[model samples]
Target: MEATLSLTDKSGVADVRRRAIHMAQALGLSEKLQADAALIVTEAATNIIKYAGQGEITLKSFLEGASQGLEIIALDRGPGITNLASARTDGYSTGGSLGAGLGTIARHSALFDIYSVPGNGTALLARIADSRDGALNGFQIGAKSTPKPGQAVCGDAWGVRQIGTHLWIALLDGLGHGPLAAEAANRAVSIFLLAELSDKPADVLRRVHQGIKTTRGAVMAVALFDTDKRMMSFAGVGNIVGIVSSGSETEHLISTDGTVGYNMRTVRPSDVAWSKGSVFIATTDGLSTRWNLNRHPGLTDRHPSLIANVLYRDFARDADDATIIVVKAT
Candidate 1:
């Protein structure tokens, strides 16, 4: 459900454009939407080659209710946009070409967001859902799930479920890499989404643990967010990292050192105060734990998807499957 392509020269543009169109067709998007995907990736690839000299494009497909969406993340370490505001305008261009790129990209996208720093890099996010009406209102989510460089299947998985006014977010890293681990992660999510009764993080996790015993097992974390009470209850096991951040303040979520399904330990959910405009990030061990948002100016305010992309681009260890979920409080 994901593909990452490296763009270093103009010759690679056609490959990316074709990939986008094929993916759009595969996702059952309309012909117009398929054309839109072609235009977006074409413009994005051209910009990367002209401005940054080299960059990467990540294509991910997602399901929103009955509709499907294709997301594109364009990342570059070029001489960052000195005036992102002007760059986004319809008639402005610094690369001596037509300036209609950003405006056209945004116009055709169901969701669009970008972040840039003068000396740092730039991250752009655009999602074209088959239909926007199926989206649930209230908050935002951006996630990146990728397998190891040489592996065909990723061993990490994540999901979000709505329960009344609360939201349950789950992240899991299977025991190891490749097919067996992917099976474990997939099996855990099936149990997470099908359980009959409780909405509690601990209870839901218990169900998953029991259902996944036949697989290799996984390192997992679950959080339940109550929007009305502004509280989040977190329960986890192993090294799955959970973080809540706002401005310069941050808190690390606590988890016991045990693998789910294979070993048993206390599963206690801890409540933390959640505030408006704060962000919660959950990650597998594939990403380095040393990331700090304070270092990336204006990143906290962009769309959750862009934030997730920037973090993944900068902090990925690249040796194992990586999955990161960035959920923002409204």
Candidate 2:
């Protein structure tokens, strides 16, 4: 389960902490761990309120390898930190009091990352696992979805499944916005989760196409990684954009000009070498394909969620539902 809480006031911060503790308990985290998670949520939400004036806190349960945990993503459009290193030091306060917010969050998390520009904004990711040393053993996944303006639920949805070195991911954007479109997207996610793991990306997409035939249809993309073969098989229909990135190079993924479950064309899957440290990203057309990762240096190496949020923040076409999926080859 995932929950997003706006941080406009102290009450919002408290609500976020409440939800964070509930999520930690749901994940079977011990009392001490749950308290630590709650404190992290409190600190992050408070930082947003005290410094940014307005922002959001997102909480979700995640499982990567043997580590099952909770992830907290804090975002704000406020003035970005001018000195991140100085801010991380204990007792350094920009908003009064003892400034242990970011530092404490990092101390309690299994994995911690922060990316901020002096003027752009700041996005922080804190992952607290049920056990110590919780890391994604072979794959790293990140995804984000935002609803159309004035809507309660987003029409875009995505899912990821990683078993050992084999990882499969699907990004689906329903025909349009609102509940009906969300239904189509949700159905695609369900099918992707239950589909056979042995199937290739194209085959899995074929199954998704057939599974959502009753809905309004969607534009979809699928990526399959087989570490044993050191290759990635990719397939897509419609305008969902996929790209493979490594260091300073990027390869744009191609897609047929049709929608799944509606006038779909032949599924053509392409193969590409899966280099270590390579990152694959897929996004619905709600984000402009004109984005360039080179514009934001060192971002690709951050957590997948941060990468998705950063892109969504900068390039999202807010007139429609937006979604981004990022996977890093581990």
Candidate 3:
């Protein structure tokens, strides 16, 4: 399950803690683990409210082989930390409170990473798993989505499934904005999750098109990667964009015109080579088509979540549901 909460005031801290505890219980965590998660969230939320004034927190479930855990991502646009190393030190207070927050969070988490710039704000990611052996089995998947202004839900959605050496990723954008559009996009995501992992990208989209015929229709992109073969197969319809960076050069995956479930034409899968350092990205039309990697040098070397967040922050349009997904071949 995935949940998001806004932290704008002191009360947000309690809400985050409650949500964290609820998530831990839902995941069958022990009482001690649940309490620890709540405390960590409380500390993170308190810092956001005290210093940043406003921020957002995302809680999502993660599975790695037989182990499962909860991942927390907190994002803010306040005055950023000038020295990350100093900020992580114990007793180094910047907001008049005890400065043990970041260090404590790192101690409780199986994986922890924080990124900040003096003017670009900050993002923190923490994951706590039940497995104490410290082994995780999965590839990285990161994305960001925000609803259009004044809308209650975003009309863009994404999904992923991995089986053995094969991985499938999908991005859907409904015909327009608002609830009806969200309905179409969410339906596509549901179908993506239910479809067989071994299905080809072209066949998968064809099935999704048929499954969501009653909805308003959506523009969809699907990418299937075979790690064992070091190759990728991609198929897309409508305006959704796909980009694959092969270290030496970037290749653009083209999508045919027409909306899925509405007026899609003949669909064909494009094959591309993928390896350990290759990067894959897909985005909805809510982003400007002019997004350039040259402008943000070294971004490809960062974590996928940070890369997605940075793209969303810089390229997202204001008038529509914005979404972007980033995945790196490993």
- Put down candidate 1 lDDT per residue, 53-102, tens digits, no spaces: 99999888976544468989999988888887678888677786546658
Question: In model 1, what lDDT does residue 211 have?
Answer: 86
- Ranking the candidates on lDDT from highest down gives 2, 1, 3
Tell me each candidate's RMSD, in Å, in order: 2.0, 2.4, 3.3
lDDT of 2 by residue, 170-228 (tens): 89999989999999999999999998878887887889889889999999988988888
User: Which scores greater on TM-score, model 1 or model 2?
Assistant: 1
Q: Score residue 152 of candidate 1 by CA lDDT.
A: 89
* Tens-place lDDT digits, model 3, residues 59-144: 98877445578878888887777887888886677787546657877888776777776776777877767774423133566788
What is candidate 3's CA lDDT for residue 216? 95
lDDT of 3 at 167: 84
> What is the TM-score of each predicted model, taking all chains together?
0.93, 0.89, 0.82
| Candidate 2 deviant stretches above 4 angstroms | 133-137, 150-153, 194-198
